[model samples]
Target: MIQIVPIDTPTLGDRSYLVGDGTVAFVVDPQRDIDRVLDLAARHGLRITDVFETHIHNDYVTGGLALARATGAAYHVNAADPVSFDRTPIRDHDVVEVGERMRVRAVATPGHTFTHLSYVLETPDRAPVVFTGGSLLFGSTGRPDLLGPSHTDELVRAQYASAHRLTGGLPDDTEICPTHGFGSFCSATQSEAERSTIGREKQVNPVLTQDEESYVEQLLAGLDAFPAYYAHMGPANTAGPAAVDLAEPRTADPAELRARIDAGEWVVDLRSRTAFAAGHLAGSLNFGLDGSFATYLGWLIPWGTPVSLLGDTPEQVAEAQRELVRIGIDRIESSATGEPEAWSGAAPLGTFPRASFTDLAAVRHHRAVTVLDVRRDSEWAGKHVDGAVHVPLHDLLHRLDEVPRGEVWVHCKSGYRASIGASVLAAAGHRVVVIDDQFDQAENAGLPMTA
Candidate 1:
């Protein structure tokens, strides 16, 4: 009997799979935390004998090499990639055997990355499952623009060829399990389905239906701005990222934390947005350690900056660090759990002013405050406040100077990003009023809407 266990990292919205044939298995696209895969293997009485990566990932570090080293398993990557470490270089139609009857056939499907591949896992009682790393996603394919503008056309064309290659050769009932497109920024688009099949894709995926030129144009046009941290991932992976050290980080007391911050270090507060708003270290930034913590932290903080973590509990601090290391932000100088004010023996920062959509509606015409919509350009284009200043959260710091000189009110699709923006503004000495409410409230409250 063959068993396939999925290990999903929800924070980054990617899935890694463990395929076993009773006694042995191989892992596909494992994340930095290898323990999860180990636990799955342990439960099933399967020893992981091999590991595979579809591509050098853009969003997080890969656990392939590290896992291989840990387990004495053969690690695989594309032969074309100039990787620094030792790995089995796989090519089109290459076959790998992990168990008595379980095998994986590598299919060269370069699109998302120049060195991408899709693997077909063959086992006892299933047709087959194709692990489409970033090349082929649910309905949409991975974005070709990740490599850079110069490489986009070349990659997009390759994406077109790769899509056909998978759909044409594979059986219609073949399971399509992709690693991207599940809310990760890596996908060009998203699909609602929990699982996909080759037949369903042939009937629905536009690349299979449209002309190459049309498909390329559509894919390119739909491309969204990715996080700034993405640039570091490709290089980090190619150079062979180190295995994550998942120890509960050494706890630091208040004085050590305060001294580190005083010497020009970053202190990230990973508390609830409400908790952060209530009280946090004066110079510390609130990333909330939720939904999009990894992306926003990597995007907003200067690269290579050593950071310390502060949270309400040890569990929260550990969770925040786990997410941070995935994006190559492992230069953690210290970590601690406590009230923000107690961390430094100084009073925590004051809570910024907040107002609801209805309250802000009455004051919309006031020349005293500017309503800043910090959503993406697409969101802003579809609808936003009539007289609001537009600046996407990712670009806010660089363009902060462009904001008008006055008190500012900030909001995103929800309260999450608004809290982040509000913190940044407050830290910068600008007066900020957080409109910590849902965007839908804006329309019902009779606020101005512009499309």
Candidate 2:
């Protein structure tokens, strides 16, 4: 009996699979942190024999090369990919046996990337399972535009063909284990379903249900901005990423923290949005641990900028470090784990007002305040508060000059991005009030909205 274990990195919305039939195992799409994989294999009493990557990833750094080297396992990647590191270049239709119970066959599924391959794992007693990396997702396919707009049309059409190719050969009950679409921006759309099969996807997935032209049109229209840091992931993965260092960073004193902030380096606070809004070190930005910490930080921060961390606990700092390393932000210049007072030194902690859409509506009745909407372009185009200044959170730092100087009320679809935006504004010496409420409440609050 083969046991397949999904090692989920929920923070990034990706899953790495570990499959074994008691004695030997293989891994697929492992994250930068390979200790989790090592520990899992140890616990399962299985020796890893192979590591596979479906494509050169563009979201987070790949752990395949490092893991394969560590365990002396054969590292499998697409033969045609222009990677710098040594790898077992497996081509389409190639089959490799893993122990006595399992065999994996490479199937070309070139929608996410031109070289993308989905692996079909077969066992004697059970239905086959396909590890669809960025190819076929649960309800949607991987976004085809990640390689830039030039290849989007070509890839979308290929993506459509790939979905059909997989279903054409596989049984209806073939389990679908995908690498993206949990919450990863790599997916064309987010999916709520936890588990699915080829049969289920045939009944619902856009790539499977719609004609190629229709699917292509809808997919191209729906893509919003992916993380800016994605520009660096592919190159790093192709060159072979180093083993991540999860060690707690060197501790910085309050004065050092202030120095880093004054030098225009990012000093991130990994607390809850509410806690950060209530009191935080002045000039420090909030990309709270409670939300998509790595995603937003990676998206917003100027690439290659020095970063320092302020968390309430060592564990928080450690978690933040793990998240940062996955995105190739390896060096955390320093970190401090303590309260706002301690990090504030002799200075007072800064704070901002947090209110709901009802309060915003009421304020609009009497006075003028800069209403800033920091959602993505698609979101802003769909519906937005009337008379709101639009600036997607990713572009906020560079476009700060466009933000009119005044009492600014910042908001996003949810309050999370709003708090981060508010912190950015407050750090720039603008008076900011975070609209700490859902955007859906705007209608109930009688705030006028425009499409």
Q: List the residue pairs that clash in candidate 2.
A: none
**Residues 1-451, model 2: lDDT tens digits:** 7999999999899999999999999999999999999999999999999999999999999999999999999999999999998999999999999999899999999989999999999999999999999999999999999999899999999999999999999999999999998999999999999899999999999898998889999999888899999999999998999898888799999899999999999999999988998899999999999999999999999999999999999999999999999999999999988788999899999999999999999999999999999999999998999999999999999999999998999999889999999999899999999999999999889999897
- Which 10 consecutive residues of model 1 have the lowest summed lDDT? 341-350
Off by over 4 Å in 2: none
- In order of appearance, the predictions have TM-scores of 0.96, 0.99
Provide the lowest-lDDT 10-residue window in model 2. 239-248
lDDT of candidate 2 at residue 92, scale 0 to 100: 98
lDDT of 1 by residue, 374-407 (tens): 9988788889988899999999989999787678
**Each candidate's root-mean-square deviation in Å?**
1.6, 0.8
Which is the leading candidate under TM-score? 2
C-alpha lDDT of all candidate models, in order: 0.86, 0.95
User: Model 1 off-target regions past 4 Å?
Assistant: 253-256, 365-367
Alpha carbon deviation, residue 158, candidate 1 (Å): 1.2
Model 2 residue 188 CA deviation (Å) reads: 0.5
